[model samples]
Target: MSDPTVGQLADVVERTGRLIAGITPEQWSDPTPCSEWDVRALVAHVVGGNALFAAALSGQTVTPGDYADSADRLLAAFRAPGALEKVVTVPFGEVPAPIALHLRLADLMVHGWDLAQATGQRADYPDDVVEQALAFSRSALPLVRKQDGPFAPSEPVDLDASALDRLAAFLGRKVG
Candidate 1:
């Protein structure tokens, strides 16, 4: 399995956003695999996630205020037409580029499934990226819930299921 590039992630994000944007209003308000978040909230999470990562890639130290502002901006952008063109280049610092790319791919691939499941749409991510994500998620499980703050709860997820299922479960979502 090879790590995906930032370009690949951007492409995936665009496709995923388009898929989500096409959902009916009723579907947008429906429950998701995330349990706590509805479809709208799930979209919000994805938009907010993009903003947060954008800030990170742009070398902004993550703060609650930054997250709020960026998230608001991103939500508005998502509401507008042709707003998925934003690209964020991650700065891995001491880490290898492939590792960072793999992480971003995992993030996009998982969230794509989240949106798809919420809207009763079928989604199948690239198998190569999924495999990379599975390996990354499995290796990172010990630190998932233990990470600094603002962490999503994950209970030592296993990558025994399909890639999408494993990715969803790793991110505290149930497989539909």
Candidate 2:
């Protein structure tokens, strides 16, 4: 349970990057499951997020960049020895290393699913990763707490739904 976040984050980044890189020029303007954000915008956000997380881990700040560069920076930062356990400053506030990892992991996983669905690709992320992220989301989302916040209430889905679908539903996304 004490494993570093670098490996898992790398997995998410690779999966997400595969989808982002596959997008055709025309597909860039297409609508995503995120509704508000188009393909290019969504890609930008994910990449930008990687940059931010990288900077936070290093106790530094960064200007967001495109997909390739941001991912490069993120991986470089996370690969440093003791990077995951190092305390750093985040935009919202400073947090322990583990907490920061969880926050980014949740975003990356959900956005990975979003990118896959929008681009007509499968979003079967690693089972263990999905399970861990889903478990975190169940408690961390405002839906379960009945609080008003950015997250919408968890929507109903079939009991036999895939874990990805279930997790998306919990985040107010409907998967077909």
lDDT top scorer: 2
Task: Predict model 2's lDDT versus the native.
Answer: 0.76
Candidate 1 wrong stretches, greater than 4 Å: 60-100, 147-161
lDDT, residue 87, model 1:
40
lDDT string, candidate 1, 62-147, tens digits: 43333236544433433333323334344323344355445556766777787787777767666666776877777755554455
Q: Write the per-residue lDDT of candidate 2 for residues 114-163, one digit (tens) a residue.
A: 88888887765787777677787775554334455456667888888887
Stretches of model 2 off by over 4 angstroms after superposition: 1-4, 143-148
Give per-candidate clash totals: 0, 0
lDDT, each prediction: 0.60, 0.76
For each of the candidates, the C-alpha root-mean-square deviation to the true structure, in angstroms, is 7.4, 2.5
Give the candidate number with the greatest TM-score.
2
lDDT of 1: 0.60
